[model samples]
Target chain A: MMKPGTRLKSAVCDAEIMIIKIAESADLSCGGQLMAEAPERTEGDGDRMHGCLIGKRYVNAEETIEVLCVKSGDGSLYYEGQELMTKDTKKLPSSD
Target chain B: MNIALLLQMAAEACPDRCALTHEGRHYTFSELFAAAQRAAHHFLAAEVKFVALMDVSSPAVPIALMGAAMSGVPYAPINYRLSEAQLTPLLDRISPAYLITGSEIVAEDRSGWVVRSSEEFMSVVSEGEISDLAWHDDPSAVAVQLFTSGTTGEPKAALLRHEHLVSYILGSVEFMGADEAEAALVSVPPYHIAGISAVMSNIYACRHIVQLPNFDPQVWLTLCAEQSVTSAFVVPTMLSRIIETLQQGAMATEALSSIKSIAYGGGKMPVPVIEHALALLPQVNFTNAYGLTETSSTITLLDPDDHRAALEQSDGPIRARLGSVGRPLPAVEIEIRDEHGAVLPPLEAGEIYVRGPQVSGEYEGRSVLDEAGWFPTRDAGYVDDEGYLFLSGRADDVIVRGGENISPGEIEDLLHQHSAISDVAAVGVPSEEWGETIALAVVTAAGQSITEDGLREHIRNHLRSSRVPELIQFVNELPYNETGKLLRREVRAWFAAEAA
Candidate 1:
């Protein structure tokens, strides 16, 4: 089980995800491929269809997990074999 | 995950953005990242167990902090203002460590440690190549070890794990949420939790930080205007001084107009100072952040909205909520319990206990967490019906007079509202009849005086007759630590001597 604050990378592509919430027995994947523990520089041909931009957050369908892309990649994020969607931006309260 | 990952993320996302500013010098996130990497290599070469900074805030602060985190070692920042007598014991505790210090503070005997001047340390770090970009991300690894200020007693080492700090940042702050032009001015001492928290939070939010090692009201104001500092955090005493400086027209209003928000904590803010600040700086947002080092900086913040609402609202109950420490963070849980440990209802004052992912509640060896994971904060407070937590004072500071538990904060707050009183502290002194009686030490406003009879009548009319102080003495000023915490222990001693 991936825990919140855990960083996952794709061995097949440049996709990276930071886990926001740990789901029980959820299959977290990227571009139809299982995600690995660290990022790979070389791009893979598993899925070249979607792109992940830096600073954009990707979330699962149930919204139980959210990840902000700190680095851009060619592969799209997936969970339970479904493509993750961009979450609407919510204004966070200022805490200094 | 290691807390260094926060800095790594910032460097990856905005490498060119300015990460830190000090004395007109600036370093980008990329430069800071590379510098930390180099410094980590130096630490590994020196075979040091910890990277300790016994100096003031500067570029070296972030460099050493991130370097220690990257090397999987604890980073400790010791108070530079402490005298040699007080500082020697602390240095002895962190032996076999790498100490980065300023030139003037270097001691003759440097046994069991490697000491490097800040300039020498920076130059050496810059000489090395940037390697080992990936740091060990073990969540259990200790990140920063801070010494408590020891206001009431001896200082203890409070440990903050990487997971604890990371959870606090992720739960309280948004990722890359700051505007590109936004900058924060940090004046709190590096040893204080507020100083450390400001650096991590601002870096994660991508906000540029300007450090002020020695706080002067003029320098702070000047830097705010020149840097266009949008945010700042100050202790209550600093805020009081700033408010006084600004109110005296010593600094231009235009200089301070650029400040969008200011957060004050690290001590209880007197009602008069905060009210005066609100009246003077109407444009700025005011936040009251309340937390302890054991809780990783801030578990509760009276946000800007709460500040504005309390000022605008007319209802007394609603307006008085201004004095509260706001509600607990979504990730933290707080309970008020009586002496026997029974949980108290809202509006009933009792000992404050907290449990959360970020609450370390730890020292070096002994864990303060109870069987149920609750850490007794040893602070007496209550939550209003609206869930706003109001702190009375430290449990040790409470006064017991003739078997009646009385909070000194209540009396102090009431007396502070008097027009002639500038500062006041209520301490319990030995009494012959009553076991202990409250003695009030007061500082009259500039060129102003109030008779002891007049003050006694004010307290009696405002509160019950039992609440009136038995002994009231006029003093020049009350003692306070550097971080703005009242030295109640010292105050009681002073009052005792005066009575004798």
Candidate 2:
């Protein structure tokens, strides 16, 4: 999660400025594994099952990051803590 | 006989009054009149008859327009936006005896009589003293010939007489309360009827006119603020851009506040946009002007008060009727007629027939008018109980699917409400089963990802199953002709080819 004082740049306009604060974050899940006191001897043991073990489960979470940024004069361009090259500028051929 | 005489009389009455302005240069009525007199002498020397003008909006346009009138020769202003292929056809039709052009647009074939610039025309006129000539006063004499947009077919030249043009200007000035004190900034192309009418109306009122070579949102906003423009006319597209710019804080409201009225037409204005405009700029008045080239400009105007009242009375239903062009202007008669040419009652949709002094009775080389004297507008619309007229797109634009009629405009309006959709056009595609199925060509907003299924579902939520498009094609932008009107046929063909 982005904390307060962390800057975020606008992905669209590439406007760069400082972010005042981070809005919020969400918990995510990967995959679950069975817990045991020690190493398991067999892959499958009827009595060794923690409950009525059907299959391993995992936690999945979606995250959204929000940050406040300073506004620029150009509506087509938006920036966060640090200005990055915009798509419009990159669309042009490089002189070098 | 000659409308030039009237201009000369007005010039004589107010010689020092500001008549035209271009790029900080101002021309008084007398100066403009003298310039026209000079140009007329040159035309006399060349023995030229019909002339064509191809130039941007500047003092030169009015000078050439009036000079041709004074010289007893009709002038045709060609839209510079037209392709050479389209222009060649029109040039062949008119076969103008002489062509007057600016340095910017020089025709390669100089075989015809050509005047390179207004300065050159003036030079020829300055070589000799101003000659006294009799003004032609015949109302039947052609003053200008404007070509149609050719959306239905090949563009036809609509011949307008001096009387018709003058009557339109007089009626518009009276209805809009335009006077000498008003300053107008015109952004539409000079070739269209709206641009021509705006310039002529300002001249009739003897007001200062600020011309923009083209419509740029930033430039338009800047000029409005800088020039302190009081009144102007624009299409809905330009209005949309202006509002978008304002919302983004790209333009200053203080400058925009100087404008008193903005007349918009050339397609329906979405009610949401209208409401946004009123909320943003409460000081300015909005007018929905409705007309065609055949009518020489506005035939009706829906005032801001009527617009607000319509929205207040009904919910979304009244918003649908906001597409109505509004009540006919004074001295203009509007009638809704059935297929048999019989008049229909109020609120019944039918062919709109209009008759007024400003309406053209015939085309240049063809007879499109009926024996009755009223010109069939070829637009399908009806008058409400309040006498407000509502237009439902062009008659030819109606899509017939499974024996049911649908207006592309209605579907397009609904599609615009989608957050991912930026613009859309609905066209009828060939279908073996239904005879014709609804198809949509859509332009998504920048950085927004939208799939055909997503769009179909979005439309389904707002419309009936039958009303939803069978096919949706995503495009970067919709194809438009020179006049900024959607080319539905081309769009449909593009989608068909893509699917193939």
Candidate 3:
């Protein structure tokens, strides 16, 4: 989904993501397959590129498309074959 | 996405983790989630416009909060400390409501007000079977309505949408990042924004929450030890009292041995109090969170590293950072704007403006964000050359004398550095020569004495004559609200009466 706050599950792996920011019609893929809105899709093929971590955000180089990993799985998230970089968030002390 | 997404994720990932502990009753994540769903059904069945909690912190606070969010109504938490006259109109504003009380206030059948006692609320929340229900996912829907009491008219209802709160949690916290061993002690009242956000953020992080309905410093320390509370959020005054309890040997340092981090805010923290705290609890990581209800919770955080670095330095930028609220969070952008609305450069004092997804600068009917999307925070402050934010005081509280604008916080902070003064407040009194003159209220330490002229000399040594308080009134204590917010408006009213 293009809207912020929309979550998508990986078609290929168990990885789940909630969109923080994204461009319309962007080719967002994970584990070499396009992400889907829900379950009950064809099984994902190809190698399971394992790297995504729970609670980490992956963003494109332009910094426009961002997604937080709500569930981690064996998948390297990508935007048009270029791997999305895991944002290096300086873990500040929880103030709440 | 709805904040319900956070609870859903946590429940799905770790249902067995202890999510909440209140009065010795521990709830797993799944239990909290199920209770939230049941609460949602209760709200949906009641068909209320607002879900109001006229109570202090309890499991009901979170359940009602999430339930309101899931059911697409705003969760309005009213200040339980308000007088009857003050609270009546506020209560009327948010009705037709599901009013839950955790206090002695008797539940009455006001038109459309469905009153539920705290005990009733708890049982009702947890009694029903789980339902596979769908929640509203609209990002723009108002999630929370906090009634912020100003010195003027009635309290203003500040609204926070689902998007704003979710962004704050996602931006500031990692999902399921906490281990099973972690528990946070939250003592800020249920009505305070800190109390609301603390529950949401800790739930998202999968940290066990231990709510103290009433805050007693000894009780707090004892609970910290008993519950193994590794993290906590306290207002500035609470920390001082906690430190006093530790110092008095009423509670040993080992009682707080499990405390790994403590976050303090909601008022101007005196440098001396923080310094003393740091010296006493070297093992604890201290964070200074600075934000308003309008900003969702914290936009800038003085993290543990900043505290450790500042405490070790004698004098420098690092040392001065202890006086600052550190830098803005990575997702937040802060600016200082002059009276004319032009952006001021670093180190120039002006009004603080913030821009971020989490900033919900909206009241019930009006939005405060500028066209460019920056919300002008009424709090007066400046950013250092290195981007550290130093809060002078609230813009409304600034004392204007002659042509210069004076910050009362500056004078009060300087006075706090004096050993004799235990507490202080500076306000503006009407003057003929100048529009307003300074009036200081000083609370000296027990058995300590200081003359007006001596206090004036002490102020003059550190600041200009204009900055010195014109009238010094020694008092036993400064007037502070339950949340440690200094009632400067009341202090100012007292001086105005004297002038009259």
Candidate 4:
């Protein structure tokens, strides 16, 4: 479920998936930096792992997983070069 | 002080007479005066410097405006039609203390403080008898600050004084032959100097003002008939649109029969449109007014007699004077000067300079007035032997391509003569080789078509190759500001974008 102000990322065409919490500092990272910061620890229930992965992405956790990555400006996570979750999954207020 | 005193005198002289009407509600002079007094007291309590008005023409406009003046606070009527980006710059510059609006508008966050609703201000004035408040009689005090359309740059606020306002009303009454009993159906927006001047003149003459929220051709026609409006003012663009509406049978001719004088300004009325309007309404008196915001709306008026006389002269003086804006009003002096500020000979085009009591000396933060007290109008025109002024176009609007000067109006006039062309604007676009190149944007007549090659050929046959537009673009409609004046900067931008 999309929560207000939560951040998510995915690359559906690339078959990749990622989720993250939005943070002010995370905004400076380009697509390369975000793709390189995939977390390593993947142990827990689905929801707990989800929160941990999102938190790791927000903090720029530098760990790699065995998934092809594609980059995009929209905050979408990708796995195996395919989008999994998008910025729309998070109910953030429009910057405009 | 004079305007406040005039209102008080008018109220006392004719308490029972209708002073203003808007949206089916009428206010007598006594009631309107009381409302203005109440608003004055409220402003006094707030101790604000300026009252910003944001609405179209309404009965509340005059009351709040006069009330602000009576309390010695300058009133600025901001054009509500301006985009947020445009409005921001003006709000930052003026920083008005209070905003007076009707129910239709939503106050933006940028407006620092606001006094909403004319009814709210009037209610406060009605709560107490503050009619005896001593009037501030400073002639030099800024009575109103009207913003220009900002077609070229950021809008400049033209500060008009109490004396200037009175002069405009008194002079226009004599020129327009307006009397105290005349009721004017006003359709011009309040933000424009012309609109405000029209309302103030009616008040100064102690005539009834029937205010429309905005210019609607159908509503304007109906009101003129229903209210028995004897006099009215509109820009040439509105006149053209009204004529089109009538031709389409959307409006009836009887609705326009009651109007005595229909004054037009803002731009030149094509000879054909003026002739058609005259033929359609023979009973109505038509006048073409020529002035700027800096001149309190109108400085010269080409009356119907001048129009007929110009047509009668076979030498094209009338057609030439159709390009001319007419002679200066009483107490005003106009001169044509060369680049060096030296006076030019008659019939020679140069910068038009105006000096008079009604003319504003300087703009806020900009000294346009020279040491000799003449303000360069930046308009290129010359006076003929008959003492009539003819405008070529704006001096800035003149294009210099390959070291040769070209007036866009000359090209526009030619395009207007084309049977298949409905409307046209010619602009000079930047070029690497020639510095500037001629470009034309045209709107075609209904059910008519023309190829670019054919248009170029047509132009080449009539004018020099250099004068013919190098580029032609067809558009559904030309971009115009709220007052119907072409947006030259916007047109240039559109051409640039298309080229890219």
Top TM-score model: 3
Report the lDDT of model 3 for residue B426.
92
Evaluate every candidate with DockQ and list the scores. 0.43, 0.00, 0.61, 0.00
Residue pairs with backbone atoms closer than 3 Å in model 1 (clashes): none
The CAPRI classification for model 2 reads as incorrect
TM-score of each: 0.94, 0.78, 0.95, 0.79
Q: Highest lDDT among the candidates is held by which one? A: 3
RMSD list, candidates in order: 2.3, 30.0, 2.1, 27.8
Candidate 2 on B1-500: residue-level lDDT in tens?
24464355446446687766677877777787888887765555666656677666766677777887877788788877666777777776656345655644445664546555655654554346677876555666788888878777888888888768866654455212235666788877767888777666666556677888778888999888877788777777787788899899987778786788777887667666777787788777678888888887788778776666666765654655556777787768999997689999988888899988788866886657777668898888789887889886787777789988787877887877777878888988878888888988889888888888887887788877788898888878887764457777788787688668
The chain A TM-scores for the candidates, taken one by one, are 0.75, 0.26, 0.83, 0.18
Query: Candidate 3, after superposition: displacement of residue B336 in Å?
Result: 1.2
Better of 3 and 4 by DockQ: 3
Query: lDDT of each prediction vs. the true structure?
Result: 0.85, 0.66, 0.87, 0.68
User: Can you tell me which runs of candidate 1 are displaced by over 4 Å?
Assistant: A1-6, A18-27, A38-70, A82-92, B103-109
For candidate 3, the TM-score of chain A alone versus the native chain A is 0.83
TM-score of chain A of 1: 0.75
> Which regions of candidate 3 are displaced past 4 Å?
A9-15, A26-39, A48-54, A72-85, B103-107, B151-153
Lowest lDDT block of 10, candidate 2 chain B: B170-179
